[model samples]
Target: MTQVNKALTAFQVPIIDVTTDEAIFEGEGWDAVVVIATSLAEIKQDEVSLLAAHASQIDFRVGKSATLLFAPGLAGGRLIISPVTDSDNEYSDVRIFAKAAREGIAIAKAAGATKPLLVVPSVTDNRFANAEQVAALACGQELWQPLEARESKSLQPSLTAIGLLNTATHSLLLNAAESGRVLARDLCGTEPERMSAIGFAQYCVDAFADSGLAVSVVDQVEQLKAQYPLLSAVGRSSFDVARHHPRVVKLEYVGEGPITKTLFFAGKGVVYDTGGADIKVAGSMAGMSRDKGGAAAVAGLMKALSILKPKGIKVIAELGLVRNSIGSDAFVTDEIITSHAGVRVRIGNTDAEGRLVLADLLSHLRLQAQTAVNPQLFSVATLTGHVVRAYGGYPALVENSAAKKQGVAATLAEVGQLWGEPFEVSRLRPEDFDKIADKNGAADVVSSNNGPSSITARGHQYPAAFLIKASGLTETELAFTHIDIAGSAVEGDPLYGKPTASPLVALLQFSN
Candidate 1:
C-alpha cells in the first residue's frame, strides 16, 4: 500500500498466449515507470530484501530513469501492465481480486513521472467493479489500518483502473474496506482490563458517529436494568464485585426519507465471558476476549451500511452489551430469565451465555420491526457449537427461511464467492432442534419430537427461527436469517497469516 492515483493503465499478467512458451524479461518495466517482476531469477531473496528496504524512502533511487519512482514485483504468466488503459488493461474490480489490483496501482503511481501512471494488465467484468477499492490500496494504505498487528501486514492483490471513473470507484471501495478494518482493529484488540463492556460499547458508538450513523448508550447499572435487563443481569454481578458499572448500547441507522422497508439486526456483545457460576476451563476461556466477535461484526456492518447508503434500506440494531464474569450476584444455572420480548427461558448452562444475550435481543428486534414497514429482521452471533460442528467451520449456517425461494440464497452465494468459503445452510422443519432432556419436565409443544439428542440440540439456525416465530412472525414473511460465524466468522489463511476480513463480506452482501 504505497501510492495508487486513479484508474490508469493495466499490467496483463495472463500467459501472453496459453500455448506460447515465450515470456517477458523478469523485472522488465511494465511502463516508463513501473517494473513487472516475480524474482530477479539470478539472486534469491536479494530482490525482496531490496524492495522492502526501498519501500519507505521517497527519494531512494532504484534506477536512473526519471519515470521510475516506486518498485513492486509481479507473478507468473502475468506481466504488470503500465498505464492500464492507454498501453495496458486493468483487471476485474471483484473484492476477491482487489488486494492484487490495489497493490499494482500503488506501486505504478509511485513512479517518478510527474503524472506517473499505474496499470493493470487485463480488463475484468462487473463482478470486479469497485473504484474506491482501487484508490484505497493506491492512496490510503496505512490510513486504513489502526491496529498494531495489521499495521505493516501487506495484504494481497493490487488494483489498477483506467480513467477517473475507475479510479473513483476503486478508491471508494478501498476506503469502505479500510473503514471497516479500523473497526476490526478495535474488535481484535479486546483485552479484559482495557476492553470492558463499556469500553467496547464506546468503540462501537464512536464508529457509528464517524460513519454518520445515530447511536445511543445506556451506561450505569440502574440505567442498564431499566433499559436492557439481560445485559444488566449478566454484568451487574461483575460490576458489584469489581465496582465497575454496566451499559446498554443501541445504534440506529435511518436511511432515505421516512423509512420504507426495514431490517433489524441483533448481536450478543459479551466483551468478555468468564462463565460466571459455571466457569470455563483454562483452554476454553483462552479466547474469551473474542467472545464479542458478533458485536464487533454487527457494529462493522452498521458502519458499512452507513457508508454504502443503499437508498431503500433502513436498519435498526440492538446489541446486548455486557461482560459475563463470576461474582457474588452472578446469574446461576436453572434461573428463569425474562427477555426483552417477555419470553421465559431456563438457563441450561451459565457458560452458554451468548444465547441468553441473543435471545433477549432477538425477541426485542422482532417487536421493533413489527412496527415498521415489511419487517425483515435477522440476528448474527458466534452462538452454539452444534451449528459449527454441523457446518464444519467452512460453511456459514443460515435458517431454512434464508435458503427459501427468496434472493437470500443468491445473495449469500455472491458474497461467499469473494473469500471462496463454503456456506452450508442448515434446514429446519419445526421445533425439532430444541434439546430435550426428557419428556417429563419440558413442555410438550416446545420439546423436540424423536430427534437426535445431543448438546448440539439448539443450533443457531432453528432456534433463531423459533425465537422470532415466538414473537409472532411467520417462517416465510418474517425474513429471519440467522448467521452463526463460529468458524467462518474468523478465517485462517496462510497468505494472510492471520484472520482475513470475513463478516465484512457477509454483512455487505445482505445490507447491500
Candidate 2:
C-alpha cells in the first residue's frame, strides 16, 4: 500500500466523552480527553469566539451543539473528517448527524487535516471504536449523507455501526470519500484511454455485485443498436481513441426488494467534444475534456448506491458515452440523427453535441417512463448553458410538476446553505421544440440570439430545454427538468465554498 495508507492503518484512534465524570486520560496505544458539552464545560457563551480564541484550534458545532478538540503546539494544518450514523436511526431524518456530517466533512477538507475525527455524540453503542478505514460509516443513520455521485462507509473496528461520531469511523468515511473522489476525478479529469467505456462499465458492475445490487452492461455496439438505437446513432458516428469500433455503452443497477421507485438517471457522456467537423476555438474549448463530467457524476452516483445499499430505493442510471472527435468518419453538420425517441434531429452544430448525447439519454428515460414505472422519476444531466445561466451559480429550477418543485425546495432548505438558489421553470413542448429541432442544423435561436427571453432569466439556452421535452414525456403532468451544467460541474465552485461535484448536493436537495 501507499505511505498515507500505511500511516492511517498504523495510527491508533481515541474516542472520548463517554462518562459522567468527564476526565482526560491516556490509554494503551491511544490518547484522549473527554469534555462534557451537555454540562458545565459546554462552550455556550460566545462559543464561536471562545473556539477562535485558541491560537492552534479545532472546533465544530451542529445546531445548538458545539465541540472543540484542540492542541496548542500543533501549528497550522488541515482537517480531515468522517460521518457516522446508526442502522435504527437511519430513517429518522435527524438534523444532528446530517448537519454534523456536512459541516464536519467541509471543515476537515478545508483545513487540510491529515486525519479527521467526527465524534458522533451517542451513548448506546460503539461502532467506529474498532472500525478501520473506508468512505463513511453509519450506526443508526444519524448522519447518513450519500454523495452517490459521492457516497460513503466506516472504519476503526471496520464494518461495524457507529451510534456516536467515532474518530475511527470519521477517518474511514474521510478515506472513502477521498478515494472515491480520486476515482471520480480519474474518470473525468484524466485521459479517456485509461477510463474507457468498457473498463469503466466493468468497475461499476463490480461495485453493484459487491453491494448486493444486480448489474448489467451492454457493450457490443450491435446489442446497443438493437435495444438503444439513439445511443448507437450518436456513438456509431464516433470513435474511441485508436479504434474505429463504433462506441456504445449501457449500464443498469438493480437494487433489492420490490423496487418501490425506479429513479431514472441519465447523463451526457461525450468523452471528448472536438466540436466535430464544425470544430471549436481553443479558448471556447479549454476544458472540453471535462465534457464527460455528467457521465462521471452518473458513475460516481452508481458507485455510491452500490456501496451503501440504501434499501427500498430502485434506481437505474443510463449514460450515453462517446467521443465526438474530428475526422472524416465523423457525423458532421446537415446530418439528421434520429433519437432513441424516434424524433428526427438535424445536427445544428457539432459543438452542440452535448445536446445529441442528452437527446438519446432523455429519450430512453421518456420511453421507460411512458412504458414502465409509475410516472414518478427524475432525470439529471450536465446538459445546458441556459439552465446554468438562469440559475447563475445557485440552485436553479426547471420543475415539470408540483411534487418535484416542493420536494427540491424543501430538501435544499433543510441542508441549510448546502445548495444555492434554484432557477425558474422553462416549458418544453412540441411547438417550441419544433422551432429549433433539427439534428443536422444548429438551433439558430441558441446560436444567434441568447438573452433573457420568454424563458430563462438571461442567455441563449434553448436547445436542451426544447429538445428534452420532445422525448417520450407527455404534455400533461409528466414533469421534466433538464440541468445544463455547462459551467456547473467542477471541483472548484465559488458558491459551494470548496472543490465539489455539485450533483451530490442536488441529489440531497432532490431527495427532500
Candidate 3:
C-alpha cells in the first residue's frame, strides 16, 4: 500500500500569506508586480502610473486583458496590468476586481514569478469597500490546485508569497478565509475513496486539533442508527465495509465575550452518492463525490472561526457524513422511516438522500437552538438538480417563515454579492409544502418526487418544506434557512470541475 500523505491542516497556501505595502517599487523583494484596477487613470500611485503610462503607449491591450510588459525600473523587470470591467453599473459589484485579479495572478504564475506583488486600487464607494480583499482572495482561488493533483504529482507551491499594495491590513483575515476555502476545496473536490466518511471525520479531527473548538466524531453503528435514523438509512448499505461506514462530526465554537448570536448548521456530507436503489445512469454519478460539498464548507467555516476567534457569537455544526451506496441492505423508495425528530417520512426517491441526512441533523440542531442565544438555524446541501436549472452557478437560499420575516436570506444574498459568492433568494410557499405532502397518507411527508429534480416543478424549493416538517420545525419561531448549493458547489464541468466552495465566503462574511 502506498503511504497516504497527510494534508496540511492549517493555512498552508503560501501565495495567500499576504503583505501590505504603501508603494509598489520600494524593495519589498517582490519578483513581479500585478496591478488590478477598474480605471488605470484614476490610480494615484506614481510608480504604477509610470508603468501604465509606458505600457499604454506600447500596447493597446494594457487595460483590456492581462497584459505583461517588460520594464527595467520595476521590482522584477515585469509588470502585468489587468482591468476590472463594468464595475460602475447598477448590477455590478466587487467581483469584477476578483475576476481581474485572478487573470493577473494567472499571468504572473505563467511568467515564472514566484513572488508577485498585487496592486489593487482601493475604491471609496461603499459597494467596493472590500474590493482589495476580494481581489487577494481571488488570486488564492486561481492559484489553488486540486488536492489529488498536488498529492499525486507531489506538486510544490509555485508562488512563495503575495504582496498587497496600497491596501488595509487584511492579511490575517484574508489568510484565514483563504485557508478555510482551501480546506473546503480539498474536501469537496477529492475522490470518493480519498474522502470517505471516516476519512473525512479524521481529517476534521486532525485539522481542529487544539484549535479550541470542541470536536467529536460519532462512528458507532448503533449510536448513529439511533441518533440519526434518516442519515443511517442512507449509509446502511455501506455499513458492512469498515472503511465505508458513516460518521457524524460535531463542532462547536464559543467566543470569549458574551454571546450575542448563536448559529446552528447541519451539513449533508454524502461522501459518495450512487443514488441508492434509484441509481443515476449515463455517467451521472461521475461527480457524486462532490455531494459532500456542504459538509466540507461547514467544516471549513468552523476552521476559520477557530482561527479568527470572533467575539460575541457561538457556532455549532453537525456534519452527517455518509455514502449512499447500493446493495441488498440499501434503503429503497416507499420505505417508511421515522426521523430523529419523531416525524414519519416516506422515501419518495432513494436518490433524494441528502435531505434525509440533513433532516435528522437539523432536528438535532433545532433542539440545541431551544436554549441558544438569538439562534439561527441553517442546513446546507448540494441536494437537487433543480437549483442548477433555476440559477446557474449560484446558490439558492430557501427560508422558512421565521427566517424570512427576519430577512435572513436577503442579508446573506447582499453579503454574497460583494464577496464574489452570489446567492439567489428563494421563497418557500404553500405549494412547496403541498408538493412534499405524502399522497398515500402513510407518512408525515415524502422525501422528494420520484422524477429528476431538474424536471420536477419546484423541485429545489419543496425540499425545504420536507426538511422543516420532518425536523419538527414546521411552525417553530426559530429562524431557519435551507441553503441549496446544487448549482454553485462546483465550477465548469459537473463531473470534473473545481469545487468553488460556494456560500462559504458569504456565510463567513454574514456571520462577521
Candidate 4:
C-alpha cells in the first residue's frame, strides 16, 4: 500500500479571458505568451506577428515545434511559439492544435512561468471551429497533476491561471469543461485503494458540494444488492472490507427552463479489476485500476453541465463503482446471477465484469426514461480491449436500434471529430445478440465468451446486445448508446499514461 493524500479541492486551475492584443504584453498579469497556429504566415495579428517573426529569425525550430525566445518587451520577457504541423496532410485533423498546445504549455511550465497567455488565431476552416477551446483544454490536459501527486506534495501546482487570448469562446465555459476533465482524470488515474468504490463516491459528493446538483451515494449493503444485483455480484468479494464496498452514486440536474431534452447516463466504475476467477495472468493487470474510466467520464459530464447550466436540458447519471477482487466470495465463470432488471445472466467470464455493472445501472436509467421527456440514454465504460484493437486511441459508440434510427451515434461522431475527440461508430448486429444467447436456454443471456475480448470476434459489439437484453431495454424504443472508451481513456503507455478524459468534451459540446 502507498501513502495517499487527497485533494481538498476539485478544480484548482483558473482560465482568464484576454480580449485584446495589448494584453499579451501588458495586461492581466500574464507571464508568458504562447501563440499556437497552423502556420506562422497565417497569423495576421500585428503584436503576435512581431514576436513570431523575431523567434523565426533566431531559431529554425520556431515553426516546427514548441520554441521559446527571449523577448524583453513581452510579459516576463518570455515568448513561446507553438506551430501545428501536418494540418495540410490528407488525414490530419484539429488534434494537431491540441498536440502543439500541450507542447507549448509544457515548455512554459518548465521555464518557471506561472501564467501563460494562450493565443489561437481564428481559422475559416469549419473543421477547426472549436480550435481555440480545444487548445485551451489541451493545456489543462497537460498541466493536470495526479491526485496523489498533489496530495503528497511530490509535484507542486504550476500555473495559477491560463489566459485565453482574443477568443469567441467564453472563459467560464472552458474552465467548466476543464474542471470536469480534471475530476474525471483524478477519478480514473488514481490507485485502487486511494480511489476505491467508496472513496470515488465521497470525492464526487465533495466535488458536487454547493454546485446545485442533487447527489446521493448508495452504499447500504441490502439496498445496493437489491437495486444493482449484477453490480453487487461483481463486488461480492470486496464486501467484507468497508472501504471496498460497492457504491452506486446517483446524480441529477434539472435546468431552469422547461426541459426539452433529457439525458440519462450509466457509468462503469470498476475501481480495480483483478479479473476474479478468470484472473489477469502475467502482466495483464498492471493498469486494471483504470477500469473505471467510463464512470469517471460520466461524472465529469455532469460536473460540466452543472456549471454551464444549459437550459431546457435535464441530466441524470448513475455510476456503478465496484472492485472485482479475487477471493472466496468472488463471482466466478459459468455462475448464474439475476440482474436488477430480472434477466438471468450466466457469467461466462469473471473478467467481463464491467458489462455486468453497466447492465444494472442502465436498467435503472431505462426505467427513468420511460417517463422522461425526449430521453436519450448512454452507457460509458472501458468495457473491452477489442475497441482498442478495432480503433486505436479512439472511443467507439455502439448504438441500439432506436439510437441508430435517430442518428445519435453519427451526430456524436461528427461533433467529436470537430472538437478533436474523435469516435468510431460501431453497429449492433444480429450476430451480436446471437453470441450472448445461451446454447441450452439455461439463462436469458451469457455475460461473455471465455476468451479475451481482444482475441474474440465481434468482442466489443456483442456486449451492447447483452446490455440491451439484460437491462430489459428492448421493452422500449428509447435511444441508447454504449460508449466503449477502453483505448481512449488513457494516452501513450496504458499502465502509466495520463487519463485523456476522452468523450467528455464531445459529450459536453453535443449536450450544449
- The sequence of per-residue lDDT tens digits that candidate 3 reaches over residues 410-444 is 99998988788888998988999999888879998
Model 1's alpha-carbon lDDT is 0.51
Off by more than 4 A, model 2 = 1-114, 118-183, 225-230, 240-258, 371-373, 387-392, 401-461, 475-477, 493-499, 508-512
lDDT by residue (1-512, candidate 4, tens digit) is 11221342333567888787777775548899888988888776776687787778777788887888887778777888899888777678889889999999999999999988888888888778888888988988888888888768756568888888874647878888987888899999999998999999988998888788999999899999998999999999999888899999999999988999999999999999999989999999999999999999999998899889999999999999999999999999888999999999999999999999999999999999999999999999999999999998989999999999999999999999999999999999999999999999889999999999999999999999999999999888999999999999999899879998888999999997
TM-score comparison, 1 vs 3, better candidate: 3
lDDT of 2 at 244: 30
Q: Tell me, what's the RMSD of every candidate?
A: 10.6, 9.6, 2.3, 2.5
What total of clashing residue pairs does each candidate reach?
56, 63, 0, 0
Stretches of candidate 1 exceeding 4 Å from the true structure? 1-168, 241-244, 392-395, 400-405, 418-422, 431-462, 469-477, 493-501
State the C-alpha lDDT per candidate.
0.51, 0.44, 0.87, 0.89
Error of 3 at 173 (Å): 0.9
What's the TM-score of every candidate structure? Answer: 0.67, 0.63, 0.96, 0.97
TM-score order, best first, reads 4, 3, 1, 2
Error of 1 at 111 (Å): 14
* Ranking, lDDT, top scorer first: 4, 3, 1, 2
TM-score for candidate 2, please give it: 0.63
